[model samples]
Each structure stands twice: as structure tokens, then as C-alpha cells.
Target: MPDLQRTRDPERWDEEEPPTLTTDVTIEQPKTIITRNQSPDIAFDRSINAYRGCEHGCIYCFARPTHAYHGLSPGLDFETRLFAKPTAAALLRQELDRRGYTPAPIAMGTNTDPYQPIERQYRITRGILELLLETRHPATITTKNHLVTRDADLLSAMAALGLMVVNVSVTTLDRRWRAPWSRGPRRRASGWRRSACWPSAAYRSTSSSRRSSPHQRP
Candidate 1:
């Protein structure tokens, strides 16, 4: 594929149809799972990223730029080629077991969507959640997939102790307002409402006050 948009000195073409984007997941064993940040702009000091790439294919996703460091295109490659940390749960356990490990809310899906399709196979997100519940650790999550509902049993338990917060990233309720990156028909407007029902008892869903994109219609 040619770097048509960002590069000017590009001359590569094979007169072939562009390859269809199919998600390719690579299992990665990370040395650590809990990422610490000291940025004043961020609310949480610690966070977890079970995966490095997102399959949502959201063109406007701010995380896309991070893919460039892996020598991958920030466009299709960012969405089709993904990485997973299967050891996230174990690493999290080690961290929490460490001396002086305080009980503060840990954020999930900070860099990439944790509930992306590959999560079903890796189950990394839920694995970490289970460990959090066992330790009575506070947690926070943001996701667009309805699969989060699957962990209602765990999340509800965490919320009961005020140890969990969840956010379902729904841009709008308009049934027709889907971008090219939208996940299939299953994510149609109704899905957001369905997500609300799934997590009400599990955790509070808090969305920012930011309005919809200016490019989108009311």
C-alpha cells in the first residue's frame, strides 16, 4: 500500500485491489501491566492496556498515532494488526501484591479499547477485573463494545463496594449516525441503550460533558 496521504515522495503501486482489513492479533508478554502516569491532565495515576491496537477502526481515534512507533501505518495497520498481553492478569497480581500497593482506581481502555473483538479470545480484560475484585481494588473502564455486559457478575460486585466505574463510549443516540469505522449493524443506535441496562447495577456509567463532533449533525 502507498502512503498517499502523509507522504509526498511515494511511488509504489502494483495495480492490485487493496487487501481487505482482517484483524491479526499477536500475543505479547509484557514485563508489566499497570502503567503509571504523572500527567496533570489525566485523572488517574495508574492504568492498564491489555492490548496495543484496536479493531474498532475508528478513523478519528486519537490513539492511532501510537502505531507509527511500531513501524506500522497509523491508518489500516493500526486497526487490522493488533497486540495482546495475555499475562496482564498475572502481572497485575504481582503489582498489587507488592508492599505499599495502595488501593486506588485503575483505569482500563486508556490507550485502546479493552473490549475489542479479540478480547473474547484473550479474555485479558475480564481476567484483570476478576483479580481486582478478589483484592477489593478500585477499577474504572471505558469501552464501546457490548461485551462488557458479559462481566456484569464481577463488575456489579465491585460496584457494591464502590470499587468500579464504567463508561460506555456512545457518541450519539441517532440511529443513522454511523461512520465508516462503525462496528457492524449490531452496534446500531439501540446498542447504546442496551449497554445502559447491562451495567446499571454493575457500575456507574459516566460520560464527559463534551458535545458531539462539530462535523456531525444534530
Candidate 2:
């Protein structure tokens, strides 16, 4: 697939209405869910992504380039078209039950946001968290969405046992950049407020970009 580029001027966001795009979801049944990596740059070796593609439509999303592997556009298609792994939890359970499977912190939202809008309906991320809690496995999460709080009960339980940590990514605090940058309703204040509900030891606030300026791209 060829590289495709799409750009929008934030200044014109208010002058013109954004195009309406319909979201399409497809259920994917994969042989496995836990993805293992040996990259020296990343802290975690294994991770789980319950869904493919993101509805947040962040123009600077690093995951957009990944969609090209499926012959899909890394532009609009990366946001409007999505895939859900309904069997994610089952596959994870199978792997964890394998012989000599040593436990390590499994990361979520490393490639895509686990708490994206579809998560509310599919609840695959929630299911994964539930399983991790049941097995007393350690896990870490990173997300910009506030929906993660919906699973606070499960997360809190895991945190109390020292099995989990949650990181909320705040890209920019400026309300002017929120909509144009992420194309989502998540506000910087809301992210901080929601993260505060969790224990300080288990909660962390991170910035995806080094600079909070609108000119800086992720």
C-alpha cells in the first residue's frame, strides 16, 4: 500500500463542518492475543490490544501507520473502520495457563487506545482486565480516554494487590487543541480528574507530546 497523507487546518475547524463518517466494525478471531516484543526501547515485553483501529481519530496517532498493513488507509479508514477481537480474553487465558508461563506486566493501549468508544459496547477490554485480576497477573494501561474509569472496580481491585498501574495520556491542555488534535471529546481536565479517583501509587499522568503547543505533532 502506498503512503497516504491527510491534513486539516485547526483554524478552519469552526468555519467548516467536518465530514460525517460512518464507523464500521468487524469481529476478528485471532489465534492469540498476547503480543510479545523484545524491543530494548519499550519497558514491557508483552501486551494486549483488544481492538484494532481507533475511533478517537487523532491525526497524530502513531498507530495509524499500522493500518496500512491491512491494505487500509492510515488516514480516515484508520478511524472510521475498526476491528474487535471478541476472543481476546479467551486467548489470553489460554496463554497464561500454558506450562512455565512466567508472569510479567502485560501492557494495554500501547498501540491503540483500549478504552475507545467501541469498548463500551464490546467490553473486551473490561473482560481482559477481569481475567488479569482473577489470575493476579500484573498489567499496565495507557490511554487518553476517560472510559477506563468505567472499569474502576476491576482496576482498583488489581491495584490494591499491587498488580496494576494506569497511565492517562494528556496530549494538550488547551481546549482549542482538544477537538482538532484528537477529534474526541476527552478534555485535559477530565483526564486528570478521572485519574485522581485512583490511588496515587497506581495512577500516572503522561504527555504523549513533549510540548503542549498546538503546533507540536505527536
Candidate achieving the largest TM-score: 2
Clashing pairs in 1: none
In candidate 1, residue 200 scores what lDDT? 33
lDDT of each: 0.76, 0.79
Q: Tens digit of lDDT per residue, candidate 2, span 1-218?
A: 99998677697646644666788999998999999999999899999999989987877688899999999999988888899998999999999999999999999998789988889899999999999999999998977777887888998788789888777665556555564425244453455465554543222224553532221111
Question: Candidate 1: worst 10 consecutive residues by lDDT?
Answer: 197-206
Candidate 1 structure quality by residue, lDDT tens digits, 1-218: 96668444345354233345678888898899899999999999999999997987776688999999999999888888999999999999999999998878899988898898888998989999999999999988887777777787887788778788777666544434433444544653344454453333221222555453211211
Model 1 RMSD in angstroms: 8.0
Please report the TM-score between candidate 2 and the true structure.
Answer: 0.81
